[model samples]
Target: MQIQKINLGAEPSGIGGDSARTSNGKVNTNFDAVVAEFADVRASIPSVTSDLGQSTTIAISQKLFTDTLMSQFNDIGVQGALGFGTGITNKLPTGMSQMQGTAIKGHENWGNYQYSDGSVMVYVPRFYYRWGHVNSPNYAKYGVNALDVKSIYDFVDVVAANAAGYALHRAFYDDGQIKDGFFVDKYQCSNNAGKASSIKNGIPLSSSSANAPFSGLTGAPANTLAGAIDAAKTRGSAFFATTIFIQRALSLLSMAHAQAATSSAACAWYDATGVNNFPKGNNNNALRDVNDTAVLYEGTGYLTAGKTGSAQPFAKTTHNGQYSGVADLNGNMWEVALGLTQTAGSFYVLRTSAKASALTSGATLATDAWGTAAMTASYDSLGASYGELTGVVRNFAIGSTTNQVFSTANSGLAWSASCAGIPQLGGAGGTNAYGNDRFYDNRIEHLCPIVGGNWSYGAYAGVWAVHCYFSRTNGDHHFGVRAALYSV
Candidate 1:
């Protein structure tokens, strides 16, 4: 017996066939057709044989019937049974290729890829988020209401749309097809020989060296940010650690902590008394992981003396407390974020040309002086437009009466939230809830943004920390660099 085809015609409209019914026509004919199709299906079942048990005969008949029915359907039916085609292909973005490496245990979302210079990169897929208070008290005080979660693309599109015609916007949206996510250095960028690398035991490159690696002024090896970008641009994709990229990285890491909480309760990461999900790097004076109580340096003397990227204690310094998340985002060293500048008490995202000038200007914001706006307007605009994306207000000033401070008692010091949407400035309240990550800014000087607190910051270093006190040309030993790749 063979399975017969049943023609249902044009879906909803033809599902019931004719509305008008006559005793010998329309509905009767439709019923007859359906009954005939059922009869064929019933006839397809094989009879139970004496040699074969009833269960075995029924199983065989079921398989035959299923095979015959499935054969009449489309490829989707076969693919569904085989668990094959998903219609979504996993393609490596430009400037990156798949690498065969030991899998990071328990982290299925993370994978290692390679750049042209053979430096390793970790791929982060895109995600969505919504705003909710960490605790009921925070909700009552801040009056933050829950919002609908949206994808990273939704946020990027808004930024691109709001800041159209700016290089900052283009650098973020036009650089690559980031809708699928992007690549970031597996570890803080290290100086290997004369090139930038992301590997274990290599010395992290300083921002001073990163500005002019071959200047001959600094004795450090050549590992400029430009070189890192060029090395990752084997396929001509934009590759650099821009503010937007760093913000996205922070967002991805914060997602785990943020989504773990109920709509009305505090998130695990945001709970003042809860376990800190963000990793503690070499932020204390002892050069140890404060969270894990592990020493980061062994018999240390100075930079690269006994300390290097992904060192034993530093292994716990990743964004996710594992090798999978971006490493050293909490401390160890401050990483430079390009394309953002604070000039004369205001903030402005630089143009592509201005970004280079920022690296060269030593005394002033002159060369990078195209866009400057008042903090009041800029802060309000940023907070109103994209603040919710991060689940926190941008450039929030900690007040004496406000419980937003790390300690409910301390006050008077103003602090800003990091891209991940957490405030870490030190105040009368001791350190802010997240980590003692501090934000430093000066109204009288032109400064560039350096993120993640440095070693010796003790109780004042975190992923949400940002320091705007250093000029683009003023790089310190504690200033380091991280690389990113935008792929299509």
Candidate 2:
């Protein structure tokens, strides 16, 4: 690893002057070079010697040496050419606007949510972006089409330290710039300001040595689940026994976190399925206590952009399930999150606890990030005609015939107060996958009101299975149902 190589293709340093009075001025330039990012266990631990109470200083210094050594050769590039130099800034990496200045790209680090109802929710990060370089301008602008088409996957294991977390990872980190940039690569920090910025580059983000690298969001992203185990085993003296205990510990924690996790707060994951030849389903606990890697794994701790709510809605709702920040709820079931709030009418109830106190809110109503509808609304109101007597769903029809029809347009179909019996399409619904299509769910909570009722939903073949939720009415009465924003 070169120590201060700049894009000039050679090491950039001062040439010793001929005159006895050499220059004594300091300049601020990126010391672009290879770096070893790791931590000193001994420095942090009290005793790690044979005496178990020996010199803390020696132990720390030793661990520090190892950390530095491993990071030097730690980066094992599996996919493309890997090198360090001032050229990093020559092509600044892009991430979520909030993750600015981070060397590592996000999304390549986490997974999304999957539910008991065969539903899944995800927030696609701005993983695909073009960098129109703006380094105070006399600078150059770069895009993916220009430099080495590298990837963060090449270093996932090194970053997370746990290949297990790589399992079930689903994400698409692409650099859309076709003409001027480089493919996604890990962000390598350049020097910092004022002090020795050189060491800044070596400060990788993850806190684990391996295995449990991810953000500490609740539920799936909890740092302690896989991470705590990694720490206990890798950092402890009894590697074997400690690992077993950690596994048991993680199970308890997962269930707890899972228990508390609401749909809106589910942790997201990266799509590790084949894009990088990663295994299909990551083993839940493969390296429970194994930290054989010679160096510390330094990468982002969390992979998600906005999964702060790890606790269950039971814990968040101010009204005790009456009202909350759920996404798949009725319009009245409102709260706020950057993503979206959904009224539960459109969402299909799919668990033993479909009602309040049973199921928590679904994944946060996420607008599409991959398709053209990312900015569309995340929820729709299941109101009036599709009324609720008590929390149960009821249907109301207005057409002369029993057959109910729906259009892509927000046609007010069943929303009549005085039994005109028309159904309506919500304007706030997320756009469907197929242009404005409708999805028919045989799993209607129940049919109500008018004599024998009929509900019909139609959309282009592409529209029915769309992302939006639909509510149906059989008769005039409203149905009673627990609602919240939902994601499938």
TM agreement with the true structure for every prediction: 0.55, 0.18
> Residue-wise lDDT of candidate 2 within 195-246, one digit each (tens)?
1011111221122224222222122222211222122122111111111111
Q: Could you give candidate 1's per-residue lDDT for residues 163-212 as a string of tens digits?
A: 32111112223222333545667666655544556765556655454222
Task: Output the TM-score of candidate 2.
Answer: 0.18
Model 2 segments beyond 4 Å from truth? 1-107, 110-384, 387-437, 441-488
Give candidate 1 regions above 4 Å deviation: 1-95, 101-109, 133-178, 208-237, 244-248, 255-275, 295-308, 313-315, 350-433
What does the lDDT read for residue 318 in candidate 1?
52
Best by TM-score: 1
> lDDT values of the candidates?
0.42, 0.18
Q: What is the lDDT of candidate 2?
A: 0.18
lDDT of 1 at 464: 63
Task: Report the Cα RMSD per candidate.
Answer: 15.6, 24.6
